[model samples]
Target chain A: GAGVSQTPSNKVTEKGKYVELRCDPISGHTALYWYRQSLGQGPEFLIYFQGTGAADDSGLPNDRFFAVRPEGSVSTLKIQRTERGDSAVYLCASSSAGGYNEQFFGPGTRLTVL
Target chain B: AQSVTQPDIHITVSEGASLELRCNYSYGATPYLFWYVQSPGQGLQLLLKYFSGDTLVQGIKGFEAEFKRSQSSFNLRKPSVHWSDAAEYFCAAAAYNQGGKLIFGQGTELSVKP
Candidate 1:
């Protein structure tokens, strides 16, 4: 089976610009999550979606960051007015609906805000 | 707040040598622990998970982890490591109450020597 897939494996943009990262979760997965990984650090949660609604978004750093999963399978993480600090690897993961289902992760999209 | 800590920033061991990577977590309640491995240019791969039942959990690629409630720790160990095991290892805790988002540690980089 195909694992989670992210488009635009690498993206470079100027500061104050906008960028969108896409994620395609495994087929039939009901939960999707986004995370950010900075250099020399582990991934930090960004947002999560259960079905078509975002169940928890407290991990989003600020209002500039938003994510949506309209069809319940593909998710897009949008960053408005990106800053240099936003440069990092954006990871996407998906899991089935359960108490402790293992998450399958994508290769991630590396965004560089210069 | 829930958090995970991997004390070792980096470790190097010869192929076929024993390996141990320590992980400690802080959470209010019984936590769901996991071990993930990330290779360069790849996504995070689940090595194992501990939700309940047996304290000792075995995983893919000859990896295993032991959960110690008395110490709030979940340490990964392998009796003999292969060169292919050289990569970054992350310890994470699932926030089940908060929509199953993961809280990851800083990660430990493992290097294999011939």
Candidate 2:
């Protein structure tokens, strides 16, 4: 079975540009998550979606970051006015609905803001 | 706040040697722990998880982990490591209250020598 997958394995943008990263979760997964991994650091949670609504967005660093899963499967993470500080690997993960399920991750999209 | 810590920034071991990667976590309640591996250009892969029941848990690719609540640790071990095992290992705790988002450690880079 195909695991979670992200589009545009790498993205480069200038500062103050806007970028969107896409994620395709597994066929039946109802839970999707986004995270950011900076150099020499672990991944930090960004947001989570259950079905079509975001259940948690506390990890989102600032107002410039936003995410959505409209159809309940594919998710898009949007960043506005990209900054050099936003340069990092954006990771997407998905899991089935329920308790304590293992998260399947995608090959993250590495975003570089220059 | 829930957090995870992987004390070793890096470790090197010869192929066929025993391996141990230490992971410690801080959470208010009984935590759901996990081990994940990531190779260059790949997504995170689950190695094992500890939710309940027995303390010792086995995972794919000949990896295993032991949960020690007394020490608030979940250390990963492998009887003999293969050259292919060289990669980054992450220890994480599931923040169930916040929609099962993962709190990851800084990660430990493992280099296997011939």
Taking the tens digit of each residue's C-alpha lDDT, what string does model 2 give over A1-114? 999999889999999999999999999999999999999898999998999999989999999999999999999999999999999999999999824788999999999999
Mind giving the per-residue lDDT tens digits that candidate 1 earns over B1-114? 788999999999999999999999999997899999999988999999998999999999999999999999999999999999999999999856766789999999999999
Model 2 DockQ, alpha carbons vs. true complex: 0.76
For model 1, the chain A TM-score is 0.98
Which TM-score value belongs to model 2? 0.98
| RMSD (Å) of each candidate, 1 decimal | 0.8, 0.9
Summarize candidate 2's per-residue lDDT along B63-100 as a digit string, tens digits: 99999999999999999999999999999998556677
Top candidate on DockQ is: 1
Residue A67 in model 1: lDDT: 97
Off by over 4 Å in 1: none
